[model samples]
Target: MFRIETHAISLVRRGLMAALIVAASVLIGATVALAESHGFAGLEGGTFAMGSGKHYREEAPVRQVTLQPFSIQKTEVTNAEFAAFVEDTGYVTTAEKDLDQSDYPGLPPDLLKAGSMVFAQPKDPVALNDINLWWRYVPGAQWRHPRGPESSIEGLEDHPVVQVSIEDAKAYAAWAGGRLPTEAEWEYAARGGLDGAQFSWGEDYDPSEGWKANTWQGVFPSIDTAEDGHHGSAPVGSYASNGYGLYDMAGNVWEYVSDWWIPGHPTKDQTNPGGPSKTLAEQFANSAVGARHVVKGGSWLCAPSYCFRYRPSARQPAERSLGSNHIGFRIVRDGVN
Candidate 1:
């Protein structure tokens, strides 16, 4: 009787384990599908309308951009989303890589120490021109620890991932069988179906009355009144989404575009103008002097007094090696799922 009972117990344990594995896989797939719910369903004329503003005309114009047709994550790849990827691939991010002091000229001994920078509500005012004011060089703010080593995403599974380097974004895309969106594709999708209008919705910069894209809520740098229900970043889809169902296209963390920093828009109608052949490793007369890469969308920190890239056409240059709290990226997969 004892021998028979032992064999039965073993069979029951194996069956339970098999059931748990099946349940876990199903739960994971559902989670991924839920995450991508906001991306473009299709490309067609719709409610959103963009106009050739100074920024648009300067960088992009009415041109033919033939996309191969790909599915991108509806919003930025959030902290929770990145954590999942890191846990699975055991991938170490660029910031996680140890930079040899010999590589960078002014890199301080502590600078080479492993960690990333994150934005914090400064107890005092910081000069926007002087980056050190707002960007805190916090140790342990990687994918797992966004705010700091002590911080966690316990309940914020949908907040856009920040402090991710281009290298980090690229690795996640590769692991997901996807890649980064080109500047053109990012613009097209962000436009949603809106024709030419000043902003994503229309000419005015109102977040109410059908223009719920992300923009400055209160005063630029000094004060964020949180008028539209967000002081920093609202939930992934807290505000209204563009026609393509993508949210936080305008104000949030600036997104990484595949193209390098190249002056001037396309002179001719083009199909995915593969960005600049080489990125300019020159000093930006405006921002920090370092490797230049293209960034789209204005972050929550943007205000009239400071950065005002609240339009889909607006673009900016970011240092490649630098990953700020206001910078992140989404992944794109060629062909629909």
Candidate 2:
């Protein structure tokens, strides 16, 4: 009968779809295995793999990939390194760029000066819903004065520099004879030999009773537990290294990457994808706002209670010109052959 024939066709379609799913899964597993063959940090302050079957990041998978290799700085760009870049290139960062009424919409007349967001005093607590409570509009909150005018990196030149914008990050990379890593490269490196990992270290948020990366230990905004031995950003290399000897690839500061987030990688076997040149705003008429750049390696402000983004593959984006105490960058240069 005609009805019987239609049922048969539907059954065939379902089987075919199932077959495709299996094939895709197999391909992804094989690709991940290849990466594993190269190296895995294993368990320590070292490896950060999440294991198979478990998803590390939501859309960003650790499955298969054939990518050209590159080197990343083991630690973030230290104040020492950034200071040198400034000396060599005399580059002015976005924080240094002047802003007017245009940059800050619906602002009061007194608040029109060019400034950047610097973390307010935790000693001074305020409501989470209130934006003005936690962030200070600092006149000099650039890579140099991090916490603003009263703050200085004088003795902490070894500390990873914060408040550097995407433009500033690019400038440093150019001067230092390197370039920024793409989102894939940044996450790959952040994993530090650990692939398909939920957190940079492993599946568990804490392990070995050993210290993890620098992050908010106690209540955010107020009362930091300081279990990681310091509050706010620590000196670079303060913690143990991952497989490739990278430090603070997790909580400390978010590093900027070369790629813009493209809803998701559209094809399999994508080689060194740099993300969509067009952004979410361009595609959607209602979305007047869009931040394309991918920020990896989550910052020290991350917490399990609020943001568990210390995981390597974690990402988000803000305007390139945006500055915050929790945002900073690392650099990548041509890797050694």
Q: What are the Cα lDDT values of the candidates? A: 0.62, 0.60
lDDT of 2 at 260: 64
The TM-score between candidate 1 and the true structure equals 0.78
Per-residue C-alpha lDDT of model 2 across residues 1-337, encoded as one tens digit per residue = 0000111011100001111111123333433333233222322222222212332333444345434556666677766666655554555666655545454455564334444677665575556655455566677667767887678777666677787767777877787677887776777776666567566676676535888788877776677888888788887778887767677888888888887654344444455566667555246212433444667777777767656677766766645555667777876655452
- Cα TM-score of candidate 2: 0.75
- For model 1 the local lDDT of residue 125 reads 54
Write down the TM-score of every candidate: 0.78, 0.75
lDDT of 1 by residue, 191-237 (tens): 76665655556567645554375455554455677766677665677
The model with the greatest lDDT is 1
